[model samples]
Target: MEKNSQAVFPNHQHSRGKAWRWTLWSVLLAAAVLIGVLQILVARAGPILKGRVVETLKTRFDSKVELDRLQVSILQGLNVTGGGLRIYPPDDVMAAGAKAPLISVDAFEFHAGLLGLVFKPMHVGAVHVRGLAIHIPPRKMRQQGAAKPRHLGKVKIEVDEIVCDDSQLVIGTDKPDKDPKLFELKHIVLRDVGPNAPWPYDAVLTNAVPKGDIHAAGSFGPWNTESPGDSSVMGDYRFDHADLNTIKGIGGILHSTGHFEGQLDRIAVQGTADVPDFSLDTANHPMYLKTEFSAVVDGTSGDTYLQPVQARLGESDFTCSGAVVNVKGKGHIIDLDVDVPAARIQDFLQLSVKTEPAVMSGVITTKTKLHIRPGPESVTQKLSLKGGFVLKRIHFTNPEVEDKVDMLSLRAEGNPKDAKPGAPDVHSLMTGQFEMSGGKLNFSNLNYTLPGASVALAGVYSLDGQQFEFTGKVRTQAKLSQMVASKWKSLLLKPVDPFFHKDGAGAVIPVKISGTKSAPKFGLNLGGKKPDQASR
Candidate 1:
């Protein structure tokens, strides 16, 4: 009986151990299945999740927002594509028709750490924005009475890298009469843009202003989201070999290379500009220029000012300051101070007129304070130049005058360099001093002397119409009177020589030259002398 009982106990114990093993295997399999099912469900719900994200953005943002597609993944953060999102201004702003929301994009990517996103300070690995466009509206002064107390909002944005490709910016003016400007940027990349970064953010972008690549590095801080106008910004930007043809009003400048380092928010700035090859096409000739300039610009008002502008052109140096003021809509006032210590008339004429090299010769010095106000139809018609010009050792070459005067021959006869001490030489030069204002040149003293004749004149010349009217007398030395040909002596001097002799030396003749610069008529005043008496 004992042997039979022990055998049954062994069998029963073995059976119970087998059942427990089966139960443990079943539980493990069920848990594995549950996890797989949950993962499948999450994957299937991606579209629903994308919709929820769009709704959340619309609810949070004040402006209109839409997204075409949002792809979520456990391994990858978010891949947003297809759809240009536009944010329209508020109803009231739209009504004013001055503000517009103009941002569009082609693709974007966002990456964030899971634990960092929910726990402490959020840390984003990277964010890339591609094919973006931002439109800027023109500046307009806000109504003083309508200004409200501004409150700034805190900005909480961080990223390791932000990249933009194929972007554009449009800048418009508040005055609809003015033209808008456009800028195209390609391949913009930025790095380490976040709070408490180890170093300032570094950025690179292509600029359309001068059509060149731009590199920048700067520290950007605690940004005020609402009142960004008051935000402080500082940076250094460099642009190399930018074409100047894109700019207005100074399209003659071919190329420019420069750098700007300052606060962009203020009106005051300082920089250096170097124009390697600038060419200007004038009516008569073309001017080539190379300039090295430095200045402090203050643009607090509607117009800007460049004080103490220094430049070099050809063999001449210039130091001037200019201002544009009282700019309302289209026209403005131009005030300039020009001072040239010395310049060559030959050089000046080469740039201003089509003339022979030896036609005009002198060393000229000029000082002027000029104000040019726009006229009804012209910019310089109402110009006023208050200045003085000094010309030393002036000489004029006229083949016609040389033949009639024959100064060289007369000099040989009068000062036969054969043993004459301190003998006067043939005079072929003059000195002039004139006061210029209101397009009129008043020559208070105009004197020139030749070997046999001399002239002293006081007259006013009109620049607008190219008219010259003078009351002067020509004085001939005794030797010159003997050399004077019959035609001039009889036709001109014979009529007024006696009357003019009372006030001057030599055989003086009152002469007048009138008409256009191209065609001049010479006449004698005679001054009450009877025709028959003058003939004699």
Candidate 2:
């Protein structure tokens, strides 16, 4: 029995070991077959799933969608890699074989949760995009009922984070053809963007046009897909040490901080621009400009209404309220009502005239309505200005001008009855109704009264050439009039006695002053010749 038991034990142990090995091998084979079957299912389901995703995107975005390649990594938590993803405009908007696409991506990657496939709400993990391009067309005025949706209507896309590595944006205009504006963004990251998420999102991006790193927080839509105009967005942005030279017409280094809170359909903004060292192509000197303004901007028409706008350029202050319509277009119109109640002419000497110290003193008051239209080849042909000017207590100290009226200070005499008791007097050196027409400045009713003489001049001055043509009657003081009367019979005065003798209280002379701004010639217009002919 012992021998038989030992032999049976050995055989039983051997048979059991063999059975264990066989079971282990069979389990390995089953696992391998299951893995093969899973791979086959993944290979078969990838294209079908990718096609369904493409169709879902097309149906949700109301656009044509295309994908070049779709890859799945089953070992990596269902990671997805999409190459050459493109979205085009709607079929109704795009013609056959059109090349323009709304959005394009070279490559994109994301990890999708399998639970969301069968669950209620889909949640996608971080999505990283590379080489993205977006094109924005210039606003076209559509009729009232022609509004379009901005985002997907019925679909909800919840993304934990979206990172864009390289992106380019282009903005272009269709009418009155102009160069497009291009902006490049690098390393743009956005967080918590979805329909059910909070409207405020965190953004970090680097803009190439203004050359700054922009950090912003904004509240955008859970978009109303039915009515895009009903969506509203607002943002607060800040950029420090931005290079303004990259932008058109501006050249300088600046810091910009502003907030834009408004509807996207009809835009409005209230902000302030602070420029420490600001320079433009049209300006001579680099200045500090600070402006605070509230404006309503038309999204479609590109027209802006700036009301109660306050601006300060250097030492000058301005409050301009008006609209500039169709800016930089063929039908550009600027209708601004500008009021400069007190602006120092000396501050802008480099912009206009070159003068020595104290050549002109006192503030100038100008109220004008500007109506400018495009001329032949955009030369500003019909530039007209109707305004009045008042120069208060102006002092003149030029060598050539002082020769006629030495160290003269004059103002328009105010009526004593209109002055308050013991109050200081209000005096204006020159008061005139001035108009600009046909590239010439006309001062029809100008009065300049001094202690020794009073001059009334009416003339037209060419602004472009700085040429003056003026004819005025200069009345001398009482004492000088008596002396000139006594010498009227003299040889020097014999040729022009009638010019000084025919006037009332003083000796009046018909004088013609005609010259360039620097060198003026004064003479008697005895033959009443036109100032232009007599200047020769």
| Residue range 57-171, candidate 2, lDDT tens digits | 6655567788998887767556778879887655443442234665788998888664444443456868899998865434331112244654554443356787887786554
Each prediction's RMSD to truth: 9.4, 7.3
lDDT per model vs. reference: 0.51, 0.61
List, residue by residue over 196-261, the lDDT tens digit for candidate 1.
332355556676545667665565534322222223444565656776555431233333344333
| TM-score to true structure, per model | 0.58, 0.70
In model 2, which range of ten residues has the least summed lDDT? 407-416
Error of 1 at 32 (Å): 8.7
User: Best candidate per lDDT, number?
Assistant: 2
Candidate 1 Cα outliers beyond 4 Å, as residue runs: 1-98, 101-107, 110-122, 130-157, 165-188, 195-227, 230-277, 283-288, 294-302, 324-335, 356-358, 368-387, 395-496, 502-536
Residue 527 lDDT in candidate 2: 75
